[model samples]
Target: MTRPAHVLYVAWGFPPARGGGVYRALATSAAFADAGARVTVLTAAREAFERYTAVDAALEAHVHPEVSVRRLPFDWPAREPDRARWSAVRRAAPRVWWRVRKELDRVSFPEVGYGPWRRVLEAGARQVHADRAVDLVVATANPYVDLVAADVLHRDHGVPYVVDYRDAWQLDVFTGRRKHRRGSRVDRLEGRLMRDAREVWFVNEPIRAWHAEQHPAAAALMHVVANGYDPQFAPAPRLEAPDPARPLRFGYIGTMSRQVPLEAFRAGWAAAAARSAEVASATAHLWGHSSHYAVEHPGSSSIPVTPGTPGTPSALPTGGSGGGVVVHGPVSKTAVAEVYAQLDVLLLILGTGRYVTSGKVYEYLASALPVVSVHDPGNAATQVLVDYPLWFPARDLSAEAVATALVSAAAAARTADRATRQACADFALASSREAQLGQRVSALLDAAR
Candidate 1:
């Protein structure tokens, strides 16, 4: 306890970037600060946040000002001007430019758009460590390039590092499929870097098990630290639900990514509404940016949707989603709870099953409201919500199955038992992001020597 381990935290989506990773990273950097460590966060520029994902000024308000945030320029090709200098392929046509860039991006790193930012990140990590010597470097991977940065810092500076795999880097978690080619160059690199990591953190048991099975020895160092709710985003005084005359208001909060089965969501929604006279009495609400809503974009094999404005939902059968599924757009973290107050039920939807334990789940559970699982049963969110007295879990993609679950969850919503409410509250008590990660970093620091 005499000396706290200085963690040079590297994350791409720190606060102000409303990407889900921001919550975990913000909570993490702040969590380290709470543990009495001097935390210097090296991240990409705020402008980058606005471009890659929706900008969350409200999220910026909750960031721990005590933590020193140093953001490097993250200017990428996508955000670049001077197409005049673009290679012939990129300069040819808008369509060709996208393909050319996609190819180049994959050549740079497995992730799109972000793969090329690796050099800046590595330099930032090393530069932060140089100006202020750090005992340990804890890098959270999403672009997964942070691992490369941490590896560089450790290799060059001997700063012991921890690689927090909020989600697995090699596994196609959604499909329960693996991406790594055995003994492939990427595989060897991942294995080598993780080999010397001081610690590794995962968000849930399934992901932990997958990583453990893949890197059995690393399991000793691996820890499963679930994504906890951010206290700042926790629901406040319950807002009255829309009038009973208004349709049942179910809501989803987070990115409208293509990976998400938006069509499936539409199907389930239509099925539920058509079957239940109650649905005629209710509407669905979606909060967040749908730029990546797979269905909204073409070329994606996911269900296709005609894309247009941001506020409207995809076109649905009989009743268009724009009318039935009202998108409120991205809310400030401060206003999140107010939005939750408007919902009779929360929709838990994500790109990947099980491996996905949405940071919002904690906040959702904390709302003490009924949640409808629009996700896989294997998800960590389910693990957290399963114990909650009021959750109705949807186990499959079947519209009938989802409709039934929604009905059940809706019924539970009307007369949510007091015990259920309290249990929801108690369930989230320790799940506060700051509290959870504070405990985690404290222990990691205690054993660091």
Candidate 2:
């Protein structure tokens, strides 16, 4: 028990990918290393980063120094419009799986792009285990296919597996939709893999509750590990201490894809700006990827692209003068707190309701900044931030209500009590991302053995 466990973690988006899960995965693996595990992370390669999402060098540095990572190469450039050179599949991609590809990419998984990565991933898992034997195989999902990779090692080499489900595979946590019908291949596969795993971890309580109801047999294995601020990226001091002078700089960081409801924020902003022109003189800056391939995903907002998508400080909006709205693009994970520091307000904008808990929410709370929520009432982040001093929850999507709420948030920002502020800091301090998972991973490792 005193000696370290050799853990091989299979996560599709680790480090460079700029996918939100990268932070959790990096932190967990790094935490495992800290908790005395000799960790070998079998993650999708740096090439995968340029293909699926933008890269974040700063986030890459956040990976623990002791952790060893193996980069697997993937050819996703075929999905892009112009890069049709190497594979015949790329040239024929248009006709071969045209309809399904569009549909899969539309919904963001299963059909195109990530679907083909299955074999590459399975091979990568085998390569890692073959290179060296492992005691535990942990897989974090969302290319839930990564679980297939872990299953390869488990089924073939008896490397016991744990499935860390940051978000449910088939269940739509936001709307409680099936995301598709039951008994589908993917759903059945997910249920089967989940059933066989040593442990299944989720990021929120409501999500764990829902899974328990669905798979009561596996309920005992399900555990909640809420996303917390990474010690590496956490703000050391209260970000900018309520900067009110030059427009109360409201900010939204992370990928604002189609589901993000940036337009809703815009709708809210339009009304709120007019109502409190004096207060909103500050800009609403967005930092993160606009879409997967530097292309605008169907529902993503077209805004300024600073640093330009992959840690390029993006901000680009086509029309409406964009006077109050700015897209700062993506920021490096290293400078995240510095980014957090400059903003007086944090905007928590997301699409779903069933039980969504964004990784950014933890950092937002940790940033010690005022938060303006544009998510559903049932959203898990709301549960965590209900006690926050300057939280403005837009229970419904009405622009007027959100506008009014913005005014209230502005008022709170101007005059929140010191104790309320301290309470906010205390709450987040207890939930440091690396620290929480360090404890959970210790238990998971013990159980898997």
Models 1 onward score TM values of: 0.86, 0.87
- Model 2 / residue 120 / CA error / Å: 4.0
Q: List the residue pairs that clash in candidate 1.
A: 247-281, 247-282, 248-282, 256-293, 257-294, 258-292, 258-294, 354-379
- Candidate 1 lDDT over 93-190, as tens digits, reads 77878877877876756677878878788888878887877888888888787777788878897878888877787887777888887687667777
- What lDDT does candidate 1 reach at residue 144? 85
Instruction: Report RMSD (Å) for each prediction in the order shown.
Output: 4.3, 4.1
lDDT of each: 0.73, 0.73
- Error (Å) of candidate 1 at residue 122 is 3.0
Q: Which 10 consecutive positions of candidate 2 have the poorest summed lDDT?
A: 312-321
Candidate 1 TM-score versus the reference: 0.86
